[model samples]
Structure formats: structure tokens, C-alpha cells
Target: MQNSLQGIELFKASVSISHQENCASGTCIDKNLLENYPPELIVGFQLLESVERSGTRRFAIHCGSADNQQHNGLLAWVFNTDLRYSFKDTSSASRSISAKCAMKVFYKHVANVQPLVNPDLGMPSVTSLEELRLPLHIYHCIKTVLEKSTSLLPPSGRKFGEWEIGLLDLESA
Candidate 1:
């Protein structure tokens, strides 16, 4: 059945992110080339929120498909980044902080949701389920966090960052 397939797929697709390394940006690292550093606060808000704060920055993400049980859909976890500011020019102190957190989604019932494109039926390929699920969960999580954190928050805005969502690939080394 679709549920069984989705459950199996969900079990295998578990994914996570981490802060691999960090260093002073003043060094001679190539300016144009941004290293693929591990997810930072912007990309790691949810996983970090679950941890007990420690001296330095380090945390583990332990998310799975509803404790290995089956559900049509469920939220794994989510959190938002602090307001960041970066200057556009050397002369100006004016800045731009990321208005959003980069998100990653771990869907419960994935494979059960058939892809829009099937050779036999020839349905037009719609957006991936991953895309649909990421924004939905992210919005829900952000709204809940902001509402609880501060009473005076701005109205919701468009997604301004990258969200690494979908069935996670864990085997890559």
C-alpha cells in the first residue's frame, strides 16, 4: 500500500546538518569562493533550538519519522535564525540581515505521494512534494516560534532563503 511504501522510504531518507567548521573570516580564504561549511544558525535554527545551550557552538539533530511509526504527514522540527546584518559597501554601516532561516524538511509519508509525472498516465510534472512540504512546515514552525518568542512581530513575508528540504540522503560520505 502507499502508506507502507512511504513509511519505508521515510525510514531510509532520514537526513541532518551540522556545523562542520568555523574560523575568522579575515584570513586569506578566497573571497569569491564560499566554502560549503556546515549549516549555520540561518540553516540550523530548528536543530539548534532543540539542544541545551553550551559553551561553544555544537549540537546534534535527532529527527526521525515520528519515532519510527507511520503517519500521513508530521512535522519533524523547526526554528528560526537571529536577525543578521551585513554591509553592502565599506562606507556604509547600513546592513541587510537575512529575514528568514534556511530550512530542511523530513517528510513522513513521501514515496506514497506519487510523482506528478508517470510515463503511463503522462500527467504534467508538477512541483516536487519536497517543495510543497518544506515551505508549509517552515512557515508553520516560524509562525509558532515568533508568536511565542516576541509579541510584537512583523507580518509574514516571502521566503528569502534556501531551504534544504525533501527526503534526506544519509549515505553520502
Candidate 2:
């Protein structure tokens, strides 16, 4: 699996892709790479330098009373590998340098495609942290892509969910 969610919503920084061998970003669709892609196409993720790993990489999406006793923070860590691309700290996410090639999705700086399984569980790749903490559009986009392609899902099967859930349905804890 190579491509994941790549685009911009109003709230977060932009996510783009690199077509270079094993750049684990996005792919071409009608000559446009703007469309999303799968994880099988993922290669090695670019590691973020210490200076680049600053600020609110993780965001508070929903404060809750469900999923667990309370759901607070989601640090959606997605990335690719490119040693040449340097980064600088910036408050504005829009103007921020592309960390797409800096962050190793699972926090590893290795330039190799690592398994997106829970470090603890190790198998039957359930809906773990790898799929957590993302924008609405990006989240939905990943579900759609995973449905079409052979990717990890809950142990029950390929179903993402029996019904759709909105933010309002969540308990505001």
C-alpha cells in the first residue's frame, strides 16, 4: 500500500505525495496526483529532524465519553522518507515546510516501509492508532480506499462500520 489520504481540509495542513520509488505518498489519476492512494504503495518514510519535530503535530479532534472512558488526543503520525528535504519551525501549518517526507508514520525515522500494526497487538490489524486521528475527509477517504484495496481492517472483516457516525453523536467529555 502506497497512497493514503492526500489533500486539504479547512482545519489542517496540506498533505501531498512523492512518486519517487517508495515515497509512500499519493499516485496519479488521469494525470493528476491530487487523488488519494493506498498503503501498499508506501515505501520508506522520510525522517523529520529534531528541529522539524516541533509544535502540535498531534491535535485534539474530539473530547469524548466513548471508545474508552474518555477520548482526548489523536496524534495522527503519517510520513515518507527524503533526507535532502530540510524543515524549519513555523506556527502556521499552511506555511509549514512539508513534513510528508519527514515524519515516519509510526514515529520511526527508518527509510523503510514498516508494518502499520499495533506495536503491542502485532496481528489481525484492527482499527488501531495508525488509522486514528485525522480530518473528517481524510478519515473517510482512507476508509473508502481500504474498502477497495486489500488493506488491514477490524478482525470482524472488511467492514469499516455498520453505520456512519457524526461528531454530534460523540459524547463531549
Residue range 99-162, candidate 2, lDDT tens digits: 3222222221122112232223545533423222344454344334323322332344322233
Write one digit per residue (lDDT tens) for candidate 1, span 61-149: 22222223322333232332233322234343665332322333322223222232221255664332121122334434433433332
Those runs of model 2 whose alpha carbons end farther than 4 Å from true positions after fitting are 1-13, 16-131, 151-173
Instruction: Please name the candidate that would achieve the greatest TM-score relative to the true structure.
Output: 2
Model 2 — TM-score against the truth? 0.21
If scored against the real structure, what TM-score would every candidate get?
0.20, 0.21
lDDT of each: 0.30, 0.30
